[model samples]
Every structure is written in C-alpha cells, then in structure tokens.
Target: MGSSVDAVVAPRGVVDLRGEAGAEFVAAYPADAVVVVSGLPGAGKSTLLRRWSGAARVRTVDPRTVHEACEAVMPAALPYAVYRPWARLEHFRLLRSSVRRGGPLLVHDCGSRAWMRRWLAREAARRGRELHLVLLDVGAATALDGQRARGRHAKARVFARHRRGLERLLAAFTRHVRSGGPLPTPEASSVLLLDAVSRSRARSVEFGAENATR
Candidate 1:
C-alpha cells in the first residue's frame, strides 16, 4: 500500500534560471540522491540530466523508438504524440521491475508534473527506492534562444508551437512545485539547476558524480 502526502505551498515569483532558482532547487535535495530533472520541452532537461549523471548512468524511460518500431501494432486512431506517455508507462514499469532485481540508478527523462511526481514518490517509497526531483527553470526568451540554436531539427517548422508548448510546460512545473510532496531526504545538501547555455564544466562534474555513484 502507498501513503498519501500533503500538498506544498511555494513562494510566488518569476523564477528564471538565474542564481536564485539553482539555490532553491539544490536546497530541496538530499545527499547521495539520484536526481530527476524536470523542465519544459526545450528547457535542456535531458542535457542537464546527462551532464549531471553522465550519459552512461542516466537510464531514460523514453520508449519513443520502441513505439515507433511497433507503430503498426498501435491503434491507428491515436497519433504518435498520444503514444508518448503510454510508452513512458512501460518504461516506468520496466524501471520498477529492474530495480527490484538490482539494476542501475536510472534517471527518467520525462515530464514529471507535480501530481505525477507524487505518484512516482509513492511507488518508489512502496518499493523502498529513493526519488529526487530537479526542475530546470528557463525563461521564455531563453527557451526561444535554445530552440533557435538547435541544429538537429528544422527550427522554423516548429518554433511557434514549441514556444506555446513551453509556456504550458512552465505553468505545469509551477503547479507541480507549489503542490509538492515529501522527498527521500528532508532537505538536500546539493541540488543543481543548470544553465545549459553556460558552465559546461560544472554540468559535466555533476554527471561524473552521478555515474560514479552508480
């Protein structure tokens, strides 16, 4: 059985990825904890997690490739995006099962809304696994800048929708944090809110540390 937790009351403000956000995030973590990075679509969540835990130690719950491979098996009525969260469900189940059988420290790269985070915490608690959340805070301009800087895709094609999506993501993040629940640690000694644009070395150290832990 799982335990229910009370909601969190957060301070209000424009929490840009400046110095303050990093301090706030780090203060919420405990020592020797596996960090879960949360942020907007283009908010560098994956980059931060990879840098903090090293790509090798970072186990993602993203089954997008798998879903794509077995696309024919999926319902034709549902779109590709609709299958995203469903695929994540499989990955989460896989992670839970693997941990039971003694697997590596997996860092999930998905949109963990506050409610979802609470659910995950409950599940982890039931299985005696620790959970930590690291929220990536970036401004609209910063997100737009990051999108414009991307070379992997045609930015011109999705820039408009991407920005709108980011806006919704940020609002969701705010709600999640405000309605926060208990963490594995009472309070974290070190929490990293990385500015993906600058400070690559520090980010690499965070990743190195996580990989070393695993």
Candidate 2:
C-alpha cells in the first residue's frame, strides 16, 4: 500500500548536484532563503555551513556547536549525557532568538526529528517566510564512516532510529511529488536532495531573485 503511494508521489524535479552542471543549480538558489541542512549526524552539514559562513546575508546555527561549548566546561572524561539537557536548552534558545531576528538563516538538523521540522515550519509561517530543506542522501555506511572520521559517535540504537525516521521522511517527500499534491507543509517551499559525491563537488549555495525582497 505504501509502495503504491510512493510511486504516485515520487519527486519529479529533484536536482542532482553531481558535476559541473550541479554548480549551476547551486548558483540559482535564492539568497535570503531560510534553509535547513539535514542529514545523519556526520553527513557534513557543519562543513557545508562553514563554506557559506562568509556570505553577508547568511546566518547559520548548529546545535553541535552548542554541545561542544558545553563539553568544554566539563571534565574531559565526562559523558555527554550529564549535560545533554543544558545543551538542548541552549540550542533551542538560540533557534528561537534567530527566528525572532528575521533574516536569511541556515540551520543544521539531523533528519530524524519531526517535531523540530514542524516548529521551524510554524516559525517560518509566522514570519511570512518559506522554509527549504537541503537533505543529504548518503547511505548509513557512509554516514557511520563520517561519524568515525569526526570522532563523534551516536549510540547504535539512536542511529537506527534516525535511519528509520529519515527513510519515512524521504518516502513522504517522494510520494508528495509523484502525486502532485499540495506541498507537505505550506511553510516549506522546496526540498533538495544531494548525495555524498554531489555534496563534495558543490561549491556554494547562492540565493536567487526570490530572496531579493526579504
């Protein structure tokens, strides 16, 4: 049943950022757009944001940065669990502050958290702005490799949960596209999917005319 629905709603215009052509697509992206960079924990979202950090109109917020800051104040041997709640509090506090400021923003997200997406969508709506998603479609093995390379590892169970949730989100996105139905969320204007290879070759994320007014 679900498979049939997915077939009907498969995305038709998903851009593949694989080569020189992909650079053109990135160039056309709208500036002043509110975008979420979502993927597994280690899928290079922070790296991508760093690449765009120099843009005058772009402001980025990543929870991991908060987590790292919290870690610095504690014992080197202490586990993250001890201060996890404080990290979460600080992260959301910053997000809320960003939303209030109302400018072009980029946020890092692990694709599993539906509530966070919904919250972002609501904030966008309230601000009369549209939210966009840049989802990295790297496989679990590659994502795990990324985690190891970064020297940060999510628990096995947590990683499994993230995989399941991301799969469901991708499926929903595909189905919505194939069906030509209303957008998954009125506040969300588009979703862009990229693979690991494509992500590596991409140079910049440019904002187009759509961002001119904002």
Instruction: Give each model's whole-structure lDDT.
Output: 0.45, 0.69
Predicted structure with the largest lDDT when compared to the true one? 2
TM-score of 2: 0.79
lDDT of the structure predicted as candidate 2:
0.69
Clashes of 1: 6
- Per-residue lDDT of 41-131 in model 2, one digit per residue for the tens? 7778878777755643488998978998999999999888988998999999998788778767889988678788889888877877667
Each prediction's number of clashing residue pairs: 6, 12
